[model samples]
Target: MTLYLLIYFIIIMGAVVAVISKKLINSAIMLALLSIGVSILLFAYNAPWAAVFELSVCAGLITVLFVSAVSLVKHDEENIKENRVKYVLLPLLLIGFIISASIIVPEYFSKLQIFSTYNTQKEEPIGKLIWLYRGVDIIGQLTLLASSVFVIKHIFFKRKEADNGGKI
Candidate 1:
C-alpha cells in the first residue's frame, strides 16, 4: 500500500543519511536499523520466514561483526574528513536492488500463495514449521557460523612467536 511505501522510503532515507554521517559506529547502528526496515517490509508483504531470516542473519550477525570490528580497533577522536558519498553508495545500491526485486519478483510468484499458505492442522506449532520445512536452512546457517569462527581464529587471533638465532 501507499502507507507502506511511504514508511519504507523514510526508513531508507534515514539509513542513507546515517551511513553518510561522520561517525562509523553510528553508521553500523543505522545499517542494523535499515535491516529492521527490510524485515518490516518482508512481514508486511506476508513473508514471515524472510522477516525472521533478515532479523537473525543480516541484522543480528552482521551487526555483531561490526561491533566486534569496532571494539578490536579502538576509536580515534580525530575528525578525519573524507568523501561522504563513498560510504553510502554500495549500501544504497543494495537497498535499491532489494526494493526492486521485492516489487518485481512477486508478479512471477503470485501463485505461490498455494504453497505458502498450506497448513496441515492447527496442532502444529511454529517450531514444527521451522524444523519440518526449514531444517536444512538451519543446518546451513550453523555451518556458516562454524566457518566464521574458524576464520576469526585463524586470521584474527593467531599470533606467531618470534624466533632469533642466539649465536652472533
Candidate 2:
C-alpha cells in the first residue's frame, strides 16, 4: 500500500514535470520517469505483462522518439525565462487534484461490486490474453509509433535541410 502510493506520487510528480517543463529534453526525461513509475505500479499490482509493455513501448521507444524530437528543436532562452514564474498555482492545482482523487476514487470504488469482478478477469496468462484478445490494440499502438517517428523525422529533416541552404 505504501509502496503503491509512493509509486503513484512519483507518477504524479513526473507527469506534472512532463507537462510543465520549458525544456523539451527535460520534458522527455520526465515523461520517461512517468513511464517508469507507471510500470512499477503495474508490476506491484501483479500485472507484469502490462508493466513490460509500458516499460518497453512508453519508456524505451517513446522516450527515444521524444529525445530525437527534442534534439531537432531549437530552444529559445527568452521563451523559457518568460514562462518560469508560475506563482505556485500549478503546484496547488496538481496537489488539489491528487488529494481529491485519492479521497473520492477509492471511496467510490469501494461502493461498487464491479471492481471485484474486474480483479478476477486478469487471472489468465497475460501474454496469451494480450496476443489473443488485444492483438488489434497492439497493432494500433505500433501504427501510432511508426507514424510518429516518420512525422518527426520528416518535419525536422526538412527544417534542417532548409536551414542548411537545401543541401541535403
Candidate 3:
C-alpha cells in the first residue's frame, strides 16, 4: 500500500540521517524518529502490540539510553584511538560476511528440496502466533534486554571506580 511505502520511506530516511549525523545527540533523536516510523508501520500492518513495544522500547528506552551513553562517555583522544581499530574491523568483517552469504546462500538454497517443500499457508491467534510460532523472537528480545542492562551497568560501574580514584 501507499501508506506502507511512505512509512517505510520515513523509517529509512530517519535511519540514514541518524547514521550520518555528526552529533551523537542528533543521531539519537533521529534514531528515535526512525523507531517511531517503524512503530507506525507496524500499526498500519495491524500489529498493535508490536507497535507498542517498538515505540516504548526502541523509540523511548533506546533513545534515552543513547542520550545517557553519549552524555556519560567522555570523548577523549585516547578513547577514540583505542576504539578506532576495533570498530573498523568489526564492521568490515560483518559486511564481508553478509556479502558472502547473500551471494552463496541463494544459489545453494534453490537446489534444496526442503526450502521448496515448506508449508506457506498457516495462521494462528496472536498469543499463539508469537509464543509458539515465533519463539526465537522472544529469545532475541531477552538477549537484547540483557545486553543493554550489562552495558549500562558496566558504564556506571566504571565511572564509579574512576571517581573513587580506581580504589573500588
Candidate 4:
C-alpha cells in the first residue's frame, strides 16, 4: 500500500483510540495528532491547500476547543453518569449507518461518472491557485482563523479570581 493510504489508516485508528480514551485531555491530544496525520497525507497527495486547511482548522482550531472545554470538566470519573446500554447501542447504530453508506457510496470515480475529462497537466503552486481560483475559500479560512482566535482568547485568557487577588 502507498504511504499516504497507510497514513490515512493510522489516522482512522488514532481517532478511534481518541474516542475511546478515558481521560478527556488524552483524547484531545490524540485528536490533534490525528489531524496532523491527515494534513501530512493531504500534502503527500499534492493537495497542499487541503493540507493547510486541515492543519489549521482541524488541528489548531480543534485543539484549542478541546483545551478550553476540558478545563471546565473535573478530571474524575465519579462526576460522570455512565450509561452502558446507550453506549453499546449507539456504536451499533453508527456501524449500521456506516455500512449503509458504504453500500450506497461509489468506491471509484468511474462508477459515478461525474467528470468528463481528467486533467493531468502540471499545475501551479497551491498558494497561487488559492489566490487565483479559490480566493473566496482562502478568505473564508482567514475569517474562521480570526473567529477561532477570538474564541480561544475569550475562553483561556479572560480575567479570573487568580488574576485578581485570590490565592491559588
Best by lDDT: 2
| Per-residue alpha-carbon lDDT of candidate 3 for residues 52-115, written as tens digits (9 for 90 to 100) | 9999999999999889878877474235535445544655675798699989998888778565
Off by over 4 Å in 2: 76-87, 113-123, 131-168
Q: What would the per-residue lDDT of candidate 1 be over residues 44-162, giving only the tens digit for each residue?
A: 88889889999999899999988777666645524466765787586868779989998888876886765696667676567897799878999998999899899978776634454
Count of clashing residue pairs in every prediction: 0, 0, 0, 0
Q: Candidate 3 vs candidate 4: which has greater lDDT?
A: 3
TM-score of each: 0.57, 0.68, 0.58, 0.62
Residues 98-159 of candidate 4: C-alpha lDDT, one tens digit per residue: 79877777665457687566678987876688789999998898999899899979877746
lDDT of 3: 0.82
* Candidate 2 per-residue C-alpha lDDT over 1-168 given as tens digits, one digit per residue, 9 for 90 to 100: 789879988998898887777777888999999999999999998888889999999999999988987776656533555545573468887689979999999889878756464554547676787799889999999999899899979876645576779876
Residue range with the least summed lDDT across 10 consecutive positions in model 4: 83-92
Q: List the residue pairs that clash in candidate 3.
A: none
Q: Candidate 4, which segments miss by more than 4 Å at Cα?
A: 2-5, 52-57, 75-78, 88-104, 107-109, 113-116, 120-122, 137-139, 145-168
Per-candidate Cα lDDT values, in order, are 0.78, 0.83, 0.82, 0.81
Pick the winner on lDDT between candidates 1 and 3. Answer: 3
Off by over 4 Å in 1: 76-81, 84-143, 158-168
TM-score winner, 2 or 4? 2
Candidate 3, residue 42: lDDT: 88
